[model samples]
Target: MSPQEKTPATLPWLTDEFLQKILRDAGGHETTVVTSSDIKPMAGGGDNYLSTMYRVSVKTKDKEEAVSTISLVVKLPPSGAEMMKLIANSSAFLTEIKLLSDILPKMFSLLRETSPEEQEEFGAKCFYAKNTMPYVLIMEDLASKGFRMAERQKGLDLRHSIVVMRSLARYHATAIALHKRDPALVESFEENFYTDSRGFVSNATLPMLRSLAEVVRSWPGFGDDYRGRLLKRADTIYDDVMELMKPEGNAFNVLNHGDLWVNNMLFRYEEVTGEVRDVKFVDFQLCRYMSPGIDLQYFIHTSVAEEIRAERVGDLLREYHKTLCATLEDLRCADSIITFQELVDEYERKALFGFFVTTMILPILLSDPDTIFNPEQSHQKEDEAIVTKRISNIHFTTVLKRLLPIYAKKNFF
Candidate 1:
């Protein structure tokens, strides 16, 4: 039997023809034969909850050319009908495939015309994609290109974060430039963050907040008054956060990477200097058109190191805006961008969005990798309580303790 006939449940779509397509699309290579192939499930943790991933290695040979190997990462929507109901209602996987196939290429076109000499490439190269049912997205395995994810536990320091700030500004600038060219650029993301996205967002967030609140109530130095504040907030947090996430009238908006945390980004280092030279953001499922503050606040609070973040968050915002303005100027979109003061004003108004998201993100971010809990497996009430308790590691509690007082003073809790 051929490889296609011998396909296992794990790799239902790995046919010889599919390998040919991946090689041809990823690069301009046409192959005549598939010589070897290997596929394996990628290790999962808190970061891999929404989808399943497999790393593929395939070797192909053209009659005229020597054998060549292609490394790829294939992403499939979560398995099982129940998981489908949870994720499909949000339309997240389709959103990501759309962004990769339709929008990003347009953004890259604008970049090439406006700033041809720039080195950084926009998001990863999608070699193969199926947009219908049983959808699959195959992309270049960035790890093979010397790009790697940063350690979630350690978080990003100043230099690393500056690299992110600059790259993010350029990406945002290209997007703004494109949006101006076509005002309907945001039409596809209309159902994003707050619109009819209640199922997963509400189902996932509210319970996590309640669980965190329970653990907070158990902490020693946390007084009942302070703990009660969070407990009360949890009752209405779904509405509270959704309200904050929506863009106000006449707001300066761009595409927000809704889940902008450490794991969603990968860094490429300069070989000799060992300096982080480039960053490629992953997980476009959450990308949406909204106030840039949504992305900024989520990133600063959840991804930046606590030491650099405590006193210098303002500085970081200024840095981000400065770079944003400069890139906008290059893209000729400066006239459409928000002023630095305006961005700071918006950031303040959205501070609670950060506080709420950070509380949920930190626990998983700082949790022991070996102890990562599967969200899909926590359907039971008791399992959820246990997951939340385990997620509240010493680091998780310390980070929250330090920030809670600050948030309280701001009257956020």
Candidate 2:
């Protein structure tokens, strides 16, 4: 088939007309062009399992220059009607579309106007989205800019954690500044999963909690008392988790990159020194307005290694608070509204937020793709059994042994 003849089935919302428009806008010229062959699927991390990603390379020729190539990453909702329906019913795709199309740009624009010096340092530049069904988002491909994903199994060390925390601070600070400048925009971020109870009661919730309980039961030193406590807690995990998800109604509230983890962030390193320098976050499907503690706890729990977390979680939280204060000051907001102590206290109170989230995703993070059960195939009885079995993989036991004690000591359980 010719390039112009490619249908939505092949490229979703991508069409020759939309391609030309994207190229022209990106290049700031009208002569840009591309072909179907220039678009190809790109390998993304686990978060991308719910969506489709593509790298589009277009050759553009200005009136006075030779042809040059422009690259963009196109993200679309999952193709299956059932999957799309589920996503639509939840806050997933709509939250992401609003974030990339509305909130981020407004925040960046405000940053440029108020804090021009730091404006260019934060966030990725997303291209305009058509914002129709099957939701397409075009953005600059970070890979072309030397950004790479951190390895999931290895987890992040102190330096990598610092980079992500600093970036996250800036992102959260922007939301605060945006709230100050445009409360309506920040208020609109309330349309997320946390605002509703349906997400906590989803089919995956009970099974995940049971798997977590089983892992706890299988731990070597786990006493019967603790195991019973964990199982009883599992029965109420959804309600407890929902309570943590509720808004704190404080000055510290900001828009969170609801799904913060190793896979959701990308980093650029210094070539010679091997030093981590820059970080950018992706996957805003779960973005929400909540206490910044939610993002902090979730990222540290799921992405940082247990050893690093054991020794340096306190330092890491301080570093994040430091950046958050500095960024808020830069944005002309009150840095003292949420003190460092308040942050620590908030984290302590909301620590179960991380525990619950970690239980759901840690197994997936540690498991290999071949061994992991396919969610799409779960309709089959055999596939359902496979998925149930895989959920109690040995990695869960290891993670539970390492983390449960810490959670208990902190009263997170």
Candidate 3:
């Protein structure tokens, strides 16, 4: 399918004809055609640019052979309008897909070859095919897994959290390994991912701040004094946030599932016993390398509640670094000097981001879905414009409140 064919609204990229060609290329008979392509909206998939689907296919090599079933999730990239890239950025949208295609399989292989005990710890089995824009990621569907994080209140438990921490730690450790083992391979991958997206984040976010200021004004608990504090903080702290968008801080500079929240995780479980089986990390559109603490802090702050997070942040950070140390030791890599204390320091520095987002972003995000997701329900001419402005204000203010104390205490800046 052409790049134009894919949009955030609907993925026309996963048409039957195109899938048939892919199956044919997978060493199946030419006559092995997709008899049916069932496309259905997947729940809890709102944070991405693509229209995600749990696809069920009926395929037949010949009339005599029983039509085989193929279950997968088809991910199409965001439309050009949905994403605004840098001017000099040439096919950066496409380049991200290629990066994932290159990195994920290598990651999977390491899990299988080096860390078999941690195999089930990671997410889906993913393979990519380039449409006109290098789009379309076909992956194992976790529908039957019965783990859904749609509700804002529900999130990863202690068990799931530990596993994800280990997996993420190992992921970064292995990337370091790859760089040491084959600097050429690492360099090539880095080249494709070379563009800095901080500009987009900075430019695109100002309007949201204004919108958030308005929302704070209207909300019941926020008084004029409180709103002023929030707004003042928003203006000052926003610059710091934008700074994070830039590529810096080696501790933060690990490839990350950019939106590593609960919704992106799918868990398998026993049908009768209702016991959990496996957790798969899905969605790669927002995947980028950044402060490794961001994902963990983001997930912990946004997914878990204040009470739980306050209690467990230190423990979780500890687990993450310990796992990293263990994984690097196993790989016999010498670059594993990061310690639990260092991780805690990183958390203290970055965990403020979690507080900022959870307090500001979650309120509206957890608001009634019809108001948030449906255009028809919007009374404003451009609901997104309104939402964006308000959220940004809230984000900036909230971030400032959380950051000032921490930044001052650490005297980092």
Candidate 4:
């Protein structure tokens, strides 16, 4: 096929016309000419499982001969037709597209009205978004602006965690304020990782539990009874998880960045001092309206470095709650702030969810990044060697050893 004839399979929304439109939108340029455009697909793993990102570098010149390079990222549903169909049927990607375009703007406007001078930008600037099938998102390239992801294996430390928690506090607080303004605004954010039409999570979690139980059984200290308890929990795991996400007894709730792990967040550091400057959250595809505790517990355990997590967990939660109350006060939602005791109670209730999530992702995170695992088929492939191998990997083994005992004492597993 001719270069002009090639289609990015109903995707590749970055066409000549789109290039002109986004440029006009991004820079407010009256007229711009695209001299050349280079599009490169992002490498797999770490970002999330639901979409693909393409980095587009466009060289443009105006009528005045002033030239500039515009760096953008184009995000699309999975390239596989089956995976695309599944996500398209669910509200995951649709929720994110709508969020970046419509909802986050309202939230940001609240921030501007309340605390403009203090907070940095909340997320990547969206130049354009289309919510229909094979949806597309075009936003500024964060990396070009000096943002980099924290090393997933190494994890975030105290300073990094403080910055991140502050951002999350602002995010959840703004969401609560917005929700109070319009109750229906959050109706669309009700679906999450388990809402796949094909029962993927149910299929995937059971096998993962069985595998985890087997490995624990092989460990030096854990006995058969421990394995039995682990396996027994699998019987009601899905229902148990879904229940935690629902509003609990009039407790405060806000939207959750459902997959809140290290890879989904990015940090920018000061150029001279190397101190962390700000935080930005990406990948809201799995977001749902749930307790902020879910995000807190998951981030504390799975993303923070172990020593910091052990020594300063209380300090971290205090930072989050203090910021939460402060931001709520800015928005006049101080009445919505949970008490310190209540915050700790809520986080403890959601701690099991964090454990399950950490157990669920550790293998994938520890595995070779070169090997991309497909979430769509992960459920039915019980016999796959990667699952077993990753379960037994020494890195995974060490984490599970510490994790299972800790969670078990809390009656989480």
Which residue pairs collide in model 2, if any?
A: none
* Residues 247-350, model 2: lDDT tens digits: 67654688889878888888998999989988888888788787888888889878887678778988898888898888788778864457889889988777
The order by descending lDDT is: 4, 1, 2, 3
**Candidates sorted on TM-score, descending:** 4, 1, 2, 3
Each candidate: RMSD to true structure? 2.3, 2.9, 5.9, 2.3
Model 3 residue runs over 4 Å out of place are: 1-17, 24-33, 43-56, 61-66, 78-96, 116-118, 144-150, 182-225, 245-252, 373-413
TM-score for predicted model 2 compared with the true structure: 0.89
Cα-based lDDT for every prediction: 0.75, 0.71, 0.55, 0.78
Q: 100-215, model 4: which lDDT tens digit per residue?
A: 88788888998889885855667888888888876888888888888988887777889999998889988999999999898787755766766554376666556767777777
TM-score, cand. 3: 0.73
State model 1's lDDT. 0.75
Model 2 stretches astray by more than 4 angstroms: 4-8, 35-37, 44-47, 116-118, 194-201, 377-396, 409-413
**What is the C-alpha lDDT profile of model 3 across 159-243, one tens digit per residue?**
6677667667877777666656665664443322223454344333333444555555655555464456556655555556545
Report the candidate with higher TM-score, 3 versus 4: 4
TM-scores of the models, in the order given: 0.92, 0.89, 0.73, 0.93
| Per-residue error (Å), model 2, residue 195 | 5.4
- Local error of candidate 4 at residue 25 (angstroms): 3.8
How high is the lDDT of residue 303 in model 4? Answer: 83
lDDT of 1 at 117: 89
